[model samples]
Target: MHSDRHEPAPLRVELAGARLAGPAPVPTGVTASRPAAAVPHPTPTQPLSPARLDTPSTWPRRTLLRLVGASAVGLPVVAALAACAEDDTVHPPDPLAAQEVLARADAAAATAAIALAPGSHAALSTIATERTAHADALRTEIDRVIGVYGDGTTPVHRTGALTVPGPGGSPVPASEVETASAQPSTLDGVRDQLVRSQQSAAALARTESGYRAGLLASISAACATQAGVLLT
Candidate 1:
């Protein structure tokens, strides 16, 4: 028989017990790799620089602002000082030397009735005589200047006690002459009045002619000299 020669069942191999023995075998065509290059740690970025502050173009505008501010502070201070130093008192002018001299003569005549100490009466008479002479001289001066004798109506006695015209067609009441002479209780008061009256007379003389000036000046001097006699 040309028969089949059968290999004996390829020597039937058996594993120890029912488990495969020896080391576990690795797979042939597979590999293990690292995570996507580990995403290399990103480096920190740098910050930008700041802008410049001081520039030549802005300097002129700053200077102008400073000058305007200084003027606003200084001008009013100068104006205030100027306002504080002004004087405003006003005095009257000399009347026609003539008519006023008579008024003065009347005032002088009244002086005799005023009570005074011994020897002062003679001095008072002298003053009255001088005032009468002054009246005559002023009459002559008035005739020379305005070509007429000054009637009593003229402004020869416009003392502070006289009421007259003022601004805006208004009439201001005149200030009264403050005198201690009318009825003084004390001698010192009379002397004070005499001094003030003489000073006022001197001021009036300054407003008159050369002759009136001399007369007023003499009267003023005589009154001043007499004041000390009463004061003592």
Candidate 2:
């Protein structure tokens, strides 16, 4: 049977003067003879470092400069597109220049009626009045197309001269001189001439549009009606 009690510690003493005493016995559960070994230390874990922001690798300086140069070169091309868009908004060309020949036929009718139409008063006056009205309408339209009003003091760029074809299919000058040079004829010849001229006017009206076209068409109808009256 082993005893349950722990053993008692031994006493220690030192001798004076001559020599040192021997080491004493150590107590239970206590270490007095040997030095204690150094305690083991725990190592601290290191914190993770943040990632570096590399600018040259992401978008190099050369690449950035190239992008800027490309943008500069495209600016004029963009401006030219804008200019073409503005030009497209300008007005369309005029369609009335060919009708200037009507002035000559109108003058010739006025001249022929006085010598050819068989009446001293109303019949002759009616023919003269219709031709005069047609001439006045032509002049007004000419002024309108040229952007000149009230006697036309200043003329714009003139309309190109009309190619007036005669009975022989030859080109004639569309002038007052051509009208004045026309020879006098009998009443039936005058009626035939006026009817042909009015038919030509009707054909011209079909080529035009808007208010000017309407005016021309009305004049053509009036001329036809007046020419028929001469026949009766």
lDDT of 1 by residue, 10-65 (tens): 43343342245653344677554443667677887755333333355666787889
Model 2 clashes, total count: 0
What local distance difference test score does each model get?
0.49, 0.58
Q: How does candidate 1 score on lDDT?
A: 0.49
Estimate the TM-score for candidate 1: 0.34
* Candidate 1 steric clashes: 0
Output the worst ten-in-a-row residue range by lDDT, candidate 1. 175-184
lDDT tens digits by residue: candidate 2, 100-121: 3553454455566567554633
RMSD of each: 23.8, 16.3
For model 1, what is the alpha-carbon lDDT of residue 189? 45
Candidate 1: regions farther than 4 A off: 1-119, 149-190, 204-209, 229-232
Cα error, residue 110 of model 1, in Å, equals: 6.4
